[model samples]
Target: MRKIIWLASYPKSGNTWMRVLLTNYLRNSATPVDINKLEGGPIASARLWFDEWVGVEAAELDDNVIERLRPGVYRCMAGETHDTLYMKVHDAWGRTDRGEALFPADVTAGVVYIVRNPLDMAMSCAHHWGVDIDTAAESMCDPTFATSRSLGGLSDQLRQSMLSWSGHVQSWLDESGLPVHVVRYEDLLAAPAATFGGVVRFCGLPFDAARVGKAVAFSDFSELQRQEREKGFRERSLRAPGSFFRRGQAGAWREELPPELVNRLIAAHGEMMKRFGYTTHQGGNDNVD
Candidate 1:
């Protein structure tokens, strides 16, 4: 029953882009896939999905109780579907308080973990969360950082623990007991065909050069941005849940990001960044084309 493929990433990473790419490749339509009408499964943290799958009243349950039941809920979800389920996930990979894995391995086919340079991601994070730049940077440095709390009332999704940027990356890449394909946001820009083609092959999906190329072209940043401009993004866009598409450049952080914040992120995420060949030094950024 191993048919669930998780597309996991920290918030503001290229998770949405990956989803669009995969969907478009599969659809292979004359036009790009609609950003708002994506066909892949909803995010793992979607509260309604849990309530529906678990067949319980979530209003009575606390976050911990709901989280504890998530693994089984996912297993049940996988059992219901005969085809592969490409699900979006933002929660850090780990076990629940009761020691059950948040995402059990038996039902998981694989994971596509997308990562972006934290330096560039900081500004985007700021815009996405409607927070100041400093708060965004600090949150990434925070090991206990979590969001989507339904404290006052219910929101669209459940609270997801991010466990800081570096920890988030480490959780899925190193800790999660599943086969993972790592995709860097910068690589998607620099080598779309090779990068996305690799992802297709890893998922055991049929990879046609023309199809992959068309998907890549269809999901281009400018195209996404233009669509957002003409209409609007239902996902996070400038914290208004509006534009969603911003500067997709790799190393633009050097000119825009504050110097002090750069040092801070480097200090917090230097090791993980180094592991992915990201510069751990101050003032450093991705050397993208």
Candidate 2:
């Protein structure tokens, strides 16, 4: 019985890029993997999957009911698949109101927790959510922050609790009792071959340097951006004002973010930022001062 390999991260923290690398690495094609036909994993919160697993419409159930049933969905997924399940998760690792682990460890293979500097993430998050930087930064600080939380209408996914950016990092790293391989998004950009290779190895996949190198090249930002420019990234937020792959650089906060806003993020997430080497904006390409 194979288990799930969770690609866990706060939003805009290189989850999709990791998926792209995995997709291309596994395919080993001469051409780039189609962005829309991504098959590395299914997002853990797909509503239709919930509907299928429970044999009832997700919309008909209360959110708490849905939350309680989520673990069952994964258990069913684990039972049904003979292969390892790679799942993308934006939700913070947490227990439900009934004291149940939202993601059951019994069914989990392991976790790859991706961390990004909150300072830079704010700008990308703002752009992705179609909000100003301040609003985005504010949301990252709020412990109650979540996505697809509309009760007025149905979203394609169930509401995913993000906690705060700092909380999100802490939950997966310190709280969840899963074996975790931590990757900083900065390292992924600056040293993709090594970083992505680590991810592949952590998931118990055989690593070939040539195959990993090819994947890194195929999943390069320019290639993804080119693909988005041509067709589109289906995973892009509907509210995103521009392409999902727009400006894949790491240190944009230095020029784009105001000094005050930068200070605010550091103040809120300083401890975790320091732990993840996000303490500065004047160091290397990622500005890990």
Which 10 consecutive residues of model 1 have the lowest summed lDDT?
280-289
Q: Give per-model CA RMSD.
A: 1.9, 2.2
- Please estimate how well model 1 matches the true structure, expressed as its whole-model Cα lDDT: 0.86
After superposing all C-alphas onto the true structure, candidate 2 shows an RMSD in angstroms of: 2.2
lDDT string, candidate 1, 1-289, tens digits: 5479999999888898899999899889999988887866778988789888888766667788888988888898888887788999999998888888999998999999999988889988888888888999999999999988756445767878999999999999999979999999888989999999999999999879999999999999888888878777776633443357778888878887888998899888887888887884443554232
Q: Where does candidate 2 stray beyond 4 Å?
A: 280-289
Query: Pairing residues by index, what is the TM-score of model 1?
Result: 0.94
lDDT computed for candidate 2: 0.87
